[model samples]
Target chain A: MTATQALVVPRGTGKTHHRPSRTWPMTVLGIIFLAIMVFPIYWMINSSLQANSGAATTAWFPVDLTFSGYEAAIQQQGGNLVTSLIIAIGTVVLTLVIATPAAYGLARFKMKGMTAFVFVLLITQMIPTIVIANALYALFNDWGLLNSYLGLILADSAAQIPFAIILMRAFMASLPQTLVEAALVDGANNFRAFVSIVVPISKNAIITAALFTFLGAWGDFLFALTLTSTPQVRPITLGIYNYLGANVQQWGPVMATAVIASVPAGLLLILAQKYIAAGALGGAIK
Target chain B: MTSLHVEAAEARSRPRPGGGRSRSRNRTLHYLTRWLFVAPAIIFVLVFFGYPIVQNVVMSLQDYTTATFYTGIAPWVGFENYAKVFGNPLFWTTVINTLLFTVGSIVFQFGIGMALALFFKRHFPLSGFLRSLLLLPWLLPLIASAAVWKWILDQGSGALNQFLGLFGVQPVPWLVSPSLALIAVIGVNIWLGIPFNTTILYSGLQAVPGELYEAAALDGAVGWKAFWHITWPSIRSVVSVVIVLGVVYTLKVVDIILGLTGGGPANSTQTLATWAYQNSFVQFLFGQGAAISNVLIAVSLVFSLAYLYMTRKEVDE
Candidate 1:
């Protein structure tokens, strides 16, 4: 949050709220630091637009912006981008279906060892993806799930299920227990009460959880890299890495892929910023 | 009708399970259905998180290989894989690299993040917009960022070298040279980490009551003294959580190193994470890979346990 919240709506009649000296100098300083931090990203986009003309130097601006690289990128990586989308969407659906109920259960029910169970869930977040990948590789190999969309979806969700549970549970916890409890008196079973009341009431939290799982699955590289061997199943994150390896001479297409690859992070910041913040806080606080 | 509904609710909410054997059985069934909501999540986490941790340990003890992928046999090799990984010179180099990478990242990220948080604490136009924009680094996939950094840090035609050329300084081999590769990687990691640190630290600063600062100002505690006395104490919990989570997350960094240098230029940027990936996938030394990762896991568990301890009160409440 910015000091706008403090200034426009007085939180307290204290020095923090009434620091009326809003300065342009601070804005300039903040912008300078931001530019420093984001220069690489700028260069990535700038390079993506410019043609790689075998020149030793890159143009500071895309003065003569070319679409050749993007054309090549689309020609080559469009399928991989589609693959990433399908996986991300699949993850969102799967996570919501599974994590929503679990979160409601944990937040509402009096499960034995609930505290210990939640603690263990938090610890699961710290388990390196490599450890999970190592075991999953063997297990998937055995179960014939490797190189399949279902496999990656299951793996990514398994890795993400704990965080999803914690996040949605934190949100769902605020719903008065009587909401579902009341529904139970209407001759509805527990499952019906959850579907009819809790799920509909917690729409924002569910979307937040779903968006986060979307982002996670979209940006996932470790699982994409280690689990899938065939190009038929490669996500764009892995496709980008593979492009960097195979097309060593083409920085243009690579940067183009990078830019295209950043769409979710960009769109989410612009569109669903509120939900993202809620999810971030949920992860930290819960 | 209302009385009948209340009766039904009372029947469902009975405190004692002694009405009859049939009633107790129904209670058990009711509770089982209630638990079914959480059962899938618990089972998934167990098979995923719980099983892998134990499997990694077991695999580290055994001799798993690419061949074992088909053969379905990884014979017990005892501690040989662990011994082999430790005895290797690359292991020590990676350990040192891991420490330097983690420490360098945390120190700069925290310092810069704190400074930014303090700056943004005051009111200004576009402050919120700019603050959110800072999260772009986190949103960009680490692999994408790494690819861009590789281009920017490219020695021969890099944007950095070209910028330095304007200063009449010679082009520096940022990623090619062994001595500078780790530093370069650390620098990029710090850049990636700053937004996260700043966002969290800024939130922490927001929670510090305005009244505390006002009270301190009345006592002539301005600037540094006010910060030390008022701000630090209030934000200490968030600060610890930030740094601990930073360490835990930073240790598992693989995509960036892989994208930027593939842990190359004589393996200068190789940490335990990248090393583990290389051994298992690249070199087909699955057992050794699992061994190094287990070490990484052990290091991570220390901080995660600390994290759990710190958050226990918040979680329970």
Candidate 2:
């Protein structure tokens, strides 16, 4: 999105050789905006570091740093963090396996019911997740999938797969048809041509989908709350939730746990910025 | 080589749009391959989305409870569940809460989001970086967001109160007060939603051809006049999309509320979504929960239909 930003930024901004007079005010105001938006995050980190440890009289800064919160947070929430990672990885693999081919087909083929299929995918997004969970709880119970990693992975992927398909399909739709058509001339079948030709071209889209799926599964609370009854398959999100349930005064550890869970998202923001931006806009526009 | 040539020739002949047995068989095979790709997704949708909807409706009509899980019997009660829901006084509170929460969140979120988008539209140094960083709140697992906000809004130790103390302002019992809980939830939700609205609205702002601004400037229509005439008109579709989606997404908000207040201080923060979860999971009254959710679904369906209608031209285009 910053790449797109360079086009619209004023001539006096980054494009210019020297600083412009008016740019400073806008920059100052912009920083103020960032500060307000990011202060809660700062507070979370600050309070986590303070020895006061959830005291009402927390200093503006840590003043005195402490690792006790981090120690407690890891000691308790570490297993759930691993659970989140496993579930997130499983969702990425499963979503890609299912959605990639479907996205390619929807983008490239003129299959019957294509419009209806797309429409269904869009409408499904509108359905409140509670409605799905209500049914899934019963279904998972009967299938003995409750509190299992596979169940949560499949359930979380349900939310990711449709959006992934739509996102990848949009990218795939713009690809030149001749890429795959040329491969067909070699004795490769449709699936083979797709695997060898189409898949390589859609790497960015697949990565975007994978990142989003990982995030969605890792951040998931609804399905994990509904489907998982025991601690065996609990996610980090739920660990923070259980911390809140205790309703303790020592929020230092709770904040630390939340900060731990948010690390990947922060890293992804700085590293995979473009794909993150694309996913943000593309998924919503559709 | 000859065989490849014949296959290419056959492919060229595909435009005939005719029906012969062999040609029809080939058409069936092609369709079959395409459907194969979509089949798994379709099956998942049917089992997950499709079945849930039908099951919810069916469950709503019966006396389904925790006992029914073991007995495999949920006697039909017809519209009794609906009647009871309509008669229940908490039902109305939930309806009002849902509307207030949805409308309040969307208004501020859209309003501030618009301001932020317009602010960042004028490209200054680091504007782009700051704008992207705004998404931090949104990208965090909402549960994590809720945990932080729950502490921040705490009457005593919360950061908000502590900050206010410097100004000699008394602590506000944000989540614990009945009148203030819903408002506080809306505030947190607005914070969560602002980044999304900004990103989309900013994208919409970008799509406005810059030439129009230049052209409008020549007409001496500057500032608000230029925006009202050119910018608003150009991005009206995006505004509609953002507003409608904000409404839809806000209507289904559960995790944040559950995390923050648990619909307490006399169930003040209970929206239809949280109420549905309370009935179904917490209280184990599946039928009543399903009934409440059906109403929520109806509400969502209205906005979703409006959204689809608004975006129809884009879809067709």
Candidate 3:
């Protein structure tokens, strides 16, 4: 599908018209399918709660529940979690600040070179993160950005900003042009009008962009793996990798750390379901 | 609202007292201000994406290494790095592994995703909820998923083995065995990719007109025949998109392999991406790594061009 076609087709719009009569049976089947697919997640949680002291003898259920794994994971990975949180928030802010205006421009301004700019944005999605990391390592080294939070945040923001622009621009393009024109006529300049009008009206798109950006930066491994040479700037992903490298026998804490690391995604999935759904489609087709 | 509209109309009709030169200058300032909106993004793309790509090409030719970091001197070595990479026997193994991994992951992910998408197309209670929940695996950090799968595929006490042992099967060395490591890594990648494939394909299925299916039912086109004749043709565009995007993505998969196998068991599971990573970071052979990654870039560019062509065709249609 073309990008515009994917955006134009409303999600699940056809479902209400032709509701199947025998849905419960299908629902049961869906639940089964879901269980099989998410079994690894269930196992991760179950193993996290069990005391598998350097052994593979983990109980299917956490019958003898223990907090020891949590204790160890918290003690070891807690700081990394904080570091990841800081970087994720930084990436979200940086990406949105850079991308929001660009989205508005691309949506509103029919300027020369806009099509080419949009094409470049699409091409950026195809560039591999390893390639970026490959060159950034040397650049960051020269610039003294290696092994720093700013360095990681900047790299992650570069990764996410293009996506944020494309996703948000799709939404902004559909917005009524008169809204901003109205603001401009009321003596506000373009930037002021955007700040007071466009930003407020585009809250949903902005939130979607922010959530995805946060998730992208939080889950980033390549930049954290390549850019940071020292443990002082480790994100939780690297924390888990380091844990795996050092303590393969201790599955409990490893699983516990995995569970801890998944909190943002899980929280967003539950609390921001609609936005997450919008983002899933937006991130892919756009 | 009425006053705002009146003001907007008045502003449009009002003529500036300034001369042509001043008005033109004002217009220039206005355009430049508009340019400010996208200027940062442009600069960012240049530095991050454009500059890196160029730097990779340059670095691949020079003898860039860890010592270059300390000495600040990378003498030009010309195609020596590329020669070393292509001459090595492991390069061919990596090339094959990369192909197998991308194809295997995309095929299974797309097939199973299409199946799930079709199943979910039927209206069902809680189907939406269950489908959304399936995104959890894709949402989690790749390393986190890798860690969980690493434990689950553990030979001794791993859950897969324990489950298999119920039928008198021996524990398989998934990541340890040279032959099986690539397959195991592919399996985990397939698991990670399924949700994205399903979500996109399911949305595509949703867009398929419901009346066509009803018409097909009337004409006795049901089950596989109905799907073959109607559903597949309708969603062909989306399928091409999903497959092409999947190829582009699966080609550069590094985190999962790094997390799961570290391209180990004597580098049995190493793909070009991971091998480049190993060359650069693990071995401090930045030039060779850049050369390998440049080759990966070229391969990706082919598919990326195909994708752009397909999408552009889609737009034209």
Candidate 4:
């Protein structure tokens, strides 16, 4: 009972031992983890700003922050920054229009074999682009759709649909069925109920689905590389490829382009950090 | 009193089975409306999604090579393309390389994610801020991350090399080395994947009641013992889901490798994904590429089915 006495001495009753606080250790570890996560991005920004004076060399910080790489990348890469922006924006629009309804369907409907259908949707998630790369290239050639905006949209859409469905389905499934039932009782038809009741309630899911699909389409490269040849339709990803020739890889401009293109996703991450974290965790756990 | 009782019985049976059948007919109409909502998506998939997948499989068996082109005949090469696949040492090499990448990514990614989750379970200052920041890598487009890493790992003058030089280590040829390239790319992937795994495992951990740990501690369980006995059981379902998903994801990953090395250094870092592309597109061996992809598809299907089965069983139990 001597050991018990030592444990009980804190409260002089039956209380456990009083331990010292662990605040500082946790804080230090948390800060270290943050640094590890943020350093690469910090390095990317710093390197992107460095001038050509030390361009051939490695320096962690910029000798002088210059916008010349950005200027050069924009001026020389393709038609203009406008073209790349337009293509990205267009991709986002196309992806949303197609993905939204599909997600709604998968989420709300208790269709026969819907679970199997979802499994199929998930299965198609990331079919190696290489598998159909040649045949697709050939098919596009035959149809004269190769390197066209329509072709890029179609290819990107194919990949986006499955992910959109999964995210949207989960979102829809979480909505209270009572509200939808109320709309039904009020004599609102299925379509009208979905539009006025179910959809408005599930706006957050819709937005998240849009954000996920848009980002995926925006950053796509392989299909962009294989599908499009002309600069007229090239997104920033493939546009950056021009800077990377067979021999000399232009690190300065490549980094600059990467920094610019990454801004939207970066900002979106911070803005929607909570939802993204939730979605990321929820999707993984489920 | 008898008349009142008869009236009550009629009222109770007013909505009969016949009426219920009519209600179902109305529901059938509602169900048709639901189909209408989902029909466009189905049509889109059938045309662009289903058609191409089926076409790709069919085309994989044909003699679609240039040799058959001049004759204008694609002769039946049933299983010959598959034979060519098994016969090639390169194909087997790609499979091995892909497996290594997948296994390495899963272990490190899950390990780091689990560690972060455990750490975050404790109430700490700026834990929320740290969690938010970690989402950057996973949220960013793979292209952007790959591009940034490409710059960071540049041999001649990259930040990674500069950082290494501080310790007097020579600059390593990250992308150029066939031996190091897959691992190098995998390292970046792990970085991208850790945040995702952390987010997932963290959420799963949060759902675990504090009472379980309190009870375990009362019984003298502490640290790893507590975790194995209490924490593991609580999060087992989520962990199983994550592992199966990790496998499927790592199997399908192509963009990172494509951006990093393009499966170069004599195809040393070539994965099944990249190999499928190379054979089908670059070599104009569409049949071979399709076969390789089918192999990937088959493997992925098996994992999905297994995960579904396990998850269903867990739910039932």
Candidate 5:
């Protein structure tokens, strides 16, 4: 048994190494590629901590680090940050509410043109948001929703639902049919069965959808910037633009605000890393 | 699994409706409930998302601007805006630039993504963490990601130049040179896009059965040969989907350019999206801007229709 166990371990190792020990070449290439990708984030973090002049100095690392940039950005954008948070959170809540039930219906019932509904959603996703940005601004202004949190929420919420529906539906359809049938035979009404049986089984997928909606809401820039004029309702992303329009570039604070704004989405990505990876790959390719 | 949990809970709470009898009132209630479940989403989209699209079409025809303020139709331009759009040299330049950027970014992005996906398939230790970390560029909001890139690519004292100096190469003006600026922006876009493609392709690759590769190896296929013979066939559907979606997405990209170059250093980097934005927002040339957007929409629609057709063909086949 000892000999057999020892044999199994090397066999596993041998099979993997069959590809070759070209580690030097592969690692060098990978490091170059990853450096190109990672440098920007590194730059952002580095510059965020440096003073204004220090940022323009030829140092990749912060020679003199400070949190004044953060302090200033937060002081300036404290209200805006709260507004962005509200809009993002609101978009997620609204999307989940609308999409979850529709997804359930699409999954369980043999609705007419269900495939068509999915197609419609794919089409909508294809349309560039900028194409409709001006028109939306005009319409929102007409309806007295321009520069309002509710307007941005409504726009983003609309964009998010189709995806949420499809994601939930796919997860639902993959579920065993007999479970729903069993619930029916157990005398639960359709609504009650869907609520209890379908919803619970699709929890992971729903959570994945919720996470995606949150990312979309948080990352949204064109719509948020275009629709809102006032600092009161503008998201953190739009606030970054104000830095560009200032008398000077203010690279330190800009980087600081950028890092600050990215934290929520970055944290979301790191925390939901598994679900997000699964969702990104599965949601599209599968 | 929320669905499964819901099913189990339903099993305990309600009395079983026997299979044999199809009750009329129950079926009616089911449909009504389903409709109710779906209505709010549909209404929300129709009011906000759907209505704006119709308004866009109407706005494109009017010669409204900041001055006119939509106080009636300025004139019934009637494709005059569109004709002028086509006639504009800058419009054509933007269109060409947009196409090039999209094509360039997609090719490199997909190539690197595919390579990474194939590498990840071997399942080395800690590969999962690497894959997750790889999502950082895609995960960061575009503004932040682009801002970070802007700082790194800044001409005077950015990270890229500073790093290059260590190797004794002269510092290059990444975002200041017209020829290099577009490519620089493209490079950042590729970074943001590759992790996403890798994840998607990796998942697609995983769904391909290991048995085929085993069989191919048994028949003496190795490395590239085995992958070509087995993996490619299995992932054809997914690859097609990715290509179509990638084209549509890359075409619509504006934020990265806006944040990084502002379509600047002589407008060499202007794409249709940014051009549309600059026209309406900066110049306040609403009519021409609307026309520019209409053209973009038309181009994108053609791409989407092709995608839809391919998807249909895949389903049919």
Candidate 6:
């Protein structure tokens, strides 16, 4: 109830606030809503454990759970999961390295065309991934980047960098200008000051950016589908897509693969809940 | 924010007693270093976004194909790609489907999201926990969600059919049938979209002062009337942002459709995005794909421009 009270009570009001007794019923209804909304995810896990019936005879629950689906999924998609992990981590590193400085520059700099640059970043988010994929396919083909990890890492980072910059810039913009200036006055250069001062203070925003970048890269399907043709560089997303392509007599392995693919998102949602919430608003409203 | 900008500017302009030439050189160095901060990102945007947009335009006008990759001989067709895209009978179906999918997803997603937002705004036990848990659908990979929903909506022994059978209702072919495929896909999209919409709108609702409701109630402006006069006007800007962003995101949705129905039962759910994918990757007709995606781009550009205009207006006000 303390959490509920914290949510219900507005700031700066010290009065004794009492929730009506009826509000408890609202909690039940809220749970039902969340249950419905999240049932697909539950079903994903449930069906993954059911025996390979090869038909729509999955029970409502995994009453007789089996590990064959997981064994099959790991045999099939373990490498792709690793590929996705490496790409996602690489995207996070590249995105933060490129976007963090740019975010700080745009936030603090009084340079000309900064607004125009920000405008362009905003516009980039609106462009469909297919258009980028179409052109990147031809470009990657010409540059010999097709079916390469670097190719996918670069493409996925491209999609995420703009949003990362925007998210971090909103946070960095609020940093007191004097914080960096004091370091500059102490004879540290801009880069050094940013490294020492801005980066540490903006840790929350940076992590939020990194988390989202990782998620974006992990969940990327079009770039993987378009840029990589062979199984060598396939991410688990495309792995699942291909699993669906086969006759799919048994969905056990498919659902197991889904559960595997969803671990990062689900884990982050639980562990980094505050950062994710901040990002959910920051990425959109800012 | 403006005050901080002015303060930073004043700090920068404060005089230092130095030789003019060295000062100019130092200033130049300073600007160069500033440019270095954003240069990589600018280059990335150029190569990834700018070049692709330009290349897509150029490709859309040519006879580019898988053969073009091999021969490097994409003859200039001079709008023939667009002509082909426009002339194809499936073109109109895609256009309508795209419109319907985007608009339908937005409408239901926003509506249900707003309702949930209002519901959660009330003080209730475990409300915060439930609301946060609601983000699971949106957080999961679209393909994963699509896979699960595909099973749940499977006609034979899918959970939905099984559940409906309890009421003696016949199995509904959610994804297989052409007539219902689009609606099913949109329903899944709405399910995916609700968490985001609800989270944003709930935050917006939270920002509305509680005092307004307390004051409105004294004048009998409670419940729906209070919401209309107080809540609606307050969250109008957030609503617009949500709607515009939703449209832009929903406009180019490819993963869900491809995973669920593959835009099929004879192309019933083939939006411009999927069509573009089919052309470029599936059929290896890069030019036609570029042309179709360019159309998608133009449609998204309209909404993006509207968003920019709205934000600018908000700033001015």
Top candidate (TM-score): 3
List the candidates ranked by lDDT, beginning with the highest: 3, 6, 2, 1, 5, 4
Q: List ranges where model 2 is wrong by over 4 Å.
A: A1-19, B1-20
Candidate that beats the other on lDDT, 2 or 6, i.e. the better one: 6
Q: Write the per-residue lDDT of candidate 3 for residues B99-202, one digit (tens) a residue.
A: 99999999999999999999987767777789999999989988999999999999999999899988999989998899999999999999999999998898
Candidate 1 C-alpha lDDT tens digits along B186-294:
9999998888788777777877877898899999999999999999998888889888888988898889889888897898999999999999888988899999989
* Best candidate (score: DockQ): 3
TM-scores for chain A, candidates in order?
Answer: 0.90, 0.93, 0.95, 0.83, 0.87, 0.93
- In model 2 chain B, the worst 10-residue window by lDDT is B1-10
Question: After aligning candidate 6 to the native by TM-score, how far in Å is the CA of A274 from where it should be?
Answer: 0.6
What local lDDT does model 3 show for residue A272? 99
lDDT, each prediction: 0.83, 0.84, 0.88, 0.70, 0.74, 0.86
Q: Could you give the TM-score of chain B for each candidate, in order?
A: 0.94, 0.93, 0.92, 0.87, 0.87, 0.93
How do the residues B1-317 of candidate 4 rate in per-residue lDDT, one tens digit apiece? 12322433443334435547778667556555665665565656655656667767787788776554346466778988889998999978998998999999999999999999888777566667777787877766677677778777888877788788889999899988988898898898889889878866776777676789899899999999999999999888778777788888888787777777888877878998888877765786777887888888788778877676655532222
Q: Compare candidates 2 and 4 on DockQ and give the better one.
A: 2
Docking class of 3: medium
lDDT of 3 at B120: 84
TM-score of 6: 0.94
TM-score for the first chain of model 1? 0.90
DockQ of each: 0.47, 0.49, 0.54, 0.30, 0.34, 0.49
lDDT of 3 by residue, A82-118 (tens): 9999999999999999999999988888654555677
The weakest ten consecutive residues by lDDT in model 5 chain B span B1-10
Off by over 4 Å in 4: A1-21, A53-56, A77-84, A132-135, A282-286, B1-28, B65-73, B313-317
Candidate 6 per-residue C-alpha lDDT over A1-286 given as tens digits, one digit per residue, 9 for 90 to 100 = 1111112224322323357576767878888888888888888899899886447577888899898999999999999999999999999999999999999999888564566677678889889999999999989998999999999999999999998988888778778999899999999999999999999999998999999999999999989999999989999999999987665679999999999999999999899998877777655632
Looking at model 1 chain A, which ten-residue stretch has the lowest summed lDDT? A3-12
Docking class of 4: acceptable
